[model samples]
Target: MEHDQELNNNLRKVKEKFMLDLVDKLNRINRDGLEYGSSALNVCYMTSIVDKQILQCEEFLKDISRGYFIEDYEEDPTGYTNGSIEIQCLNATKTYTLKFTESYCGDMAQCYPSFKLSERHGVGEYEWNYFEDDYEEYEANFNKKYSAIYKDIEQKKKERRIQDIKIQMEMLSQELTALES
Candidate 1:
């Protein structure tokens, strides 16, 4: 009987300790919220709401993204697409076509000129220089008649990958159109 009483007392102490720790954690969170002038709580609440809104936005975007296209035409001096954009995103690469114009009209004008993308477990900063020329022949004309075949292949691959991304961006833009409609 004495042993049973001792065990019960120990359990009661453990429970009290656990409750104390839980209360301390709650107090800390409350204090942090107050110390930051409720900004912390406001951010948390806003982000939670934003999370849902982002999903709705994503759905609308996905629908239109599937239909985006880039027309092939000579750009004027002022910089304009005069075409559509199309793209697809795969495991490690993407395919796309984008056109730029001086006017910020609508879908055709919404294309991003330059951007960067990187992976945590892989290479860093895969990006596009919108103004950079797709000149494999120029790069090959370096040094002797033809410096290296490997460089030529690599440059071609990089150019193709950029095109893929452009396609994906166009799709995303189409999806974004859903929000407006």
Candidate 2:
């Protein structure tokens, strides 16, 4: 509708070859969201899974990713109820949260709330510096209304969607070759 730089790039060649192809096989909801399935864009908006290690290799390349554990906090029960790590996937504009769990520390601490990045979709990295002032409020919300986001689980779910796109594109490529022949 508006001036779309992407759709306009190589205007005639791309448009003629694969308008609907890019639109549908990429699992786009509409013509407007054609970019959603692009590899560049996928690196942007993953549903979950955030860690600093994503900065390494950084290819958006590795298919299999290993998970890590991040020790978020070890605090006393004195006035401390709960906590959350708000993360923005690198290149992604939206934010998702990592909720910690209070495990027994054998009296060393009352709450040893830790974050574990489990094996999953291996989506892109994240930047968790957006809402720093929410430590107090986040604990309140996590205690009252919010549910935890399992980075591994959610990221794997998103990974499935991405896999489907890849499979379908390969089918389409074969179809195009056959048609040309």
Candidate 3:
């Protein structure tokens, strides 16, 4: 029993750290407009819903069934509960927003939660079924793309560090010559 508790505590700590890192990355992306790239964003979005607890709220189900979802945030008398995020995508020429909505089961959102890229400005709504093989392929492809992007970023950082070190060495050499004179 003691061993199980220790393991759970460690797992919880790791989960907390991961969440912090994810939130930081999301914040950076929001501020800079996909500087980390869309593949990374997509992977992060999908990974968040892994093994989610489903709560079927009859209230939300009605709106969901009718094909209408809460697109924007609103403050009810009780509180503010908007389970939607507006993601901005910046390309070479233009910037646009994509809205992602969470599908939940229960009195509110995020009960047994899943996400969908429900709407895109200038483009229409989107639907992705999990049962489809195409969906699986799409997920795999997204993961692959994200992995590649991550590796490229790491490689570029290493190259940049090397360049910085060389510049520092040059500066140090110049400083030494001036001191000797």
| Selected candidate, larger TM-score, 2 vs 3 | 3
Q: lDDT per residue, candidate 2, 1-181, as tens digits? A: 4555443343433222221222122222222233354222121112111222232322221221121122222222553323333333344333333333333444655333333322233333233332334434544443333122223333554676788999999999999999999
The models' CA-based lDDT, in order, is 0.33, 0.34, 0.40
Tens digit of per-residue lDDT, candidate 3, span 24-124: 44444433433433222333443344212111122222222323211232122342222344322222222222233444444554232244332223433
Model 3 root-mean-square deviation: 17.3
How high is the lDDT of residue 62 in model 1? Answer: 36
Q: How does residue 97 of candidate 1 score in lDDT?
A: 32
lDDT of prediction 1? 0.33
Where does the lowest 10-residue lDDT sum fall in candidate 3?
Answer: 51-60
Cα RMSD to the true fold for all candidates:
28.3, 22.1, 17.3
Candidate 3 regions exceeding 4 Å error are: 1-85, 88-145
Clashes of each: 25, 0, 10
Candidate 1 Cα outliers beyond 4 Å, as residue runs: 39-181
In model 2, what lDDT does residue 75 have? Answer: 23
